[model samples]
Target: DVKVTQSSRYLVKRTGEKVFLECVQDMDHENMFWYRQDPGLGLRLIYFSYDVKMKEKGDIPEGYSVSREKKERFSLILESASTNQTSMYLCASSSPTLLSNQPQHFGDGTRLSIL
Candidate 1:
């Protein structure tokens, strides 16, 4: 089974504090992504890394960044956590399949609250 592990199931940070969310996948997948899910809004991508050190900013990468120095690990960093950023953060991974229909396997999720 493809497994993805996220560091925290729930997190609370003060505004302006730096926050780090760690994710690790054991499926040897080449693509990993970070997303934030909100009530009215669906899953919105933050960042994605195709290779160990190759990353692309997604639609809402303004306040976030990513790092992937190892094949099994990916990290999301919030320069300054804000209350607006409070939401469920999900880490997902998928193999480098040629098909675009490849679904991303997600971690349980980390619910973050910036006070």
Candidate 2:
């Protein structure tokens, strides 16, 4: 079974502090994504990587960045945590095949709070 593991299930950080959220996939997927889920805004994309060391900005990449030094690992960096950034962060991975409907596997997500 494909598994995506997040470094933490819950985290708290002070405003203006830098935060790092880590994710690891065991399925050797080539595509990985980071998203933040909010109450009314829904899930908004943060960043995504197609391969090692390759990343692209997603819908909301202003206060965030991503690192993918290895195929199995992806890290999301919050440059400076803010009160508005508090939300549920999700990490997903998928294997791209010939079909465009590839399903992505997601971690349980990390609920982050910025105080």
Q: At residue 63, give the lDDT of candidate 1.
A: 88
lDDT of 2: 0.95
Q: Which candidate is the best by lDDT?
A: 2
User: What is the C-alpha local distance difference test score of each model?
Assistant: 0.94, 0.95
Each prediction's total of clashing residue pairs, residues at least 3 apart in sequence or on different chains, is 0, 0
* Residue 61 in model 1: lDDT: 97
Model 1, 39-101: lDDT tens per residue?
Answer: 999999999998899899998999898999999999999999888899999999999862567
TM-score against truth, every candidate: 0.96, 0.96
Off by over 4 Å in 1: none
Q: In model 1, state the lDDT of residue 12.
A: 92
Which parts of model 2 have CA positions greater than 4 angstroms off? 97-99
Residue 2, model 2, lDDT: 95
Cα lDDT of model 2 by residue, 20-60, tens digit:
99999999899999999999988999999999999999999
